[model samples]
Target: MQVNLHDAKTNLSRYVEQALDGDEVVIARAGKPLVKLVPVDSTPRRRQLGFMRNQGIATADVKGDFIDDINAMFS
Candidate 1:
């Protein structure tokens, strides 16, 4: 659906709802296309608790200061 700038501004909500319904809406200025409205993927991510609990170890369990060695290389 193509609409003029003024019409897009006036009926913004209606056009947006159309876009959300998987329709492409084009805003025009003097018969030239300026913008296309489309829906954004707003899917939520699922999070897992203790997903890799056994894959990690406590910092105190490390025998040496690993970061100190890397810093020494840059210095």
Candidate 2:
């Protein structure tokens, strides 16, 4: 679907919905195609838990040290 710049601006939300629905949207200026609208991939990536489990870092010691430092700060 092709639309003129003024029409595209006037019906921006409709065009965006059409684009998200997988329809090809083209914006034109003086009948010349200027840009295409497409939906972005908005999915967030999942973080890997326990990524440092085998990295030789002691989790319990780190937690204890952090708590001790926080207690010292508040004292």
Best by TM-score: 2
Please list the C-alpha lDDT of all candidates, in the order they appear.
0.91, 0.94
Model 2 TM: 0.61
Alpha carbon deviation, residue 59, candidate 1 (Å) = 6.1
lDDT of 1 by residue, 1-75 (tens): 999999999999999999999899999999999999988878987899888989987767333656787778789
Q: List the residue pairs that clash in candidate 1.
A: none
Taking the tens digit of each residue's C-alpha lDDT, what string does model 2 give over 13-70? 9999999999999999999999999999999999999988888955577657699888
The clash numbers for all candidates, in the given order, read 0, 0
Position 35, candidate 2: lDDT: 99
